[model samples]
Target: MAFKPQSDSDGALSEINVTPLVDVMLVLVIILLVTAPLLTQSVHVTLPKTASTSANIDAQPLQLGIDALGVITLNKQPVINLLALEATLKAEFTKNKDVGVHLYADQAVVYKKVAEVMATVQQAGIAKMAFVTVEE
Candidate 1:
């Protein structure tokens, strides 16, 4: 009887077959391409910085205050209504592009009231806004 070469068995292969892995990776890339744009269509972009000048920049923002009675005021005078606030903001911001809005709300003011004012400010198209809060 002679030894059969076909029957001789030895596990000697040390290489990984990665064709299936490559195929799965390619599928993932295609999926990303299809969905990425759809996911970000509604996004708004913030501007990037450019080197120019910081000398004229103010250290603080123009403060818009809401007292305990839910009254709106700018700097100290009562704005009386959203229209008044918008008018004042528009006038102040007409010459300055870097003007910022800071909002202070009395703790008694509800989230709805604050959000309404924020919406009005946003509609007025102010570039930046900050919520003023007290430290404990």
Candidate 2:
């Protein structure tokens, strides 16, 4: 590169020297294009197919929880009363007949509260119910 002062008759440079910037940008674009396909290369996978579709994929399970204070929740949303819980359950069942409810009751919660909630779930015509438990 040679040092050369560029100026007009007024001794002021009027135009910017953007040739180097354009060259650098073009080089970067070429590098990206060459490496893009290599970055996207992934192993070909053949996933095993099962006879029955997973419930988690088909429909999300509704979560029902009863705290030690006997407060009820459906899908983590608070329910004011058994009637409200029942209504929500009915709506869920109507939306997807195969939808299941996973009930989690705090150990300190009274059995009566849990029973009442179960009865209300039954009344809502939900046949598929599972008790969620922790491992050890």
Clash count list over all predictions: 0, 0
**Regions of model 1 farther than 4 Å from truth:** 1-54, 58-60
Candidates' C-alpha lDDT: 0.85, 0.91
Query: lDDT tens digits, residues 22-126, model 1?
Result: 999999999999999999887689989998876875645689999888999988788878888888888777767678889999999888888889988877778
| Clashing residue pairs for model 1 | none
Per-residue C-alpha lDDT of model 2 across residues 46-126, encoded as one tens digit per residue: 999979855458698899999999999987889999999998889988998888889999999999999999999999999
**How do all models score by TM-score?**
0.57, 0.58
Clashing pairs in model 2? none
Off by over 4 Å in 2: 1-58
TM-score of model 2 (CA atoms): 0.58
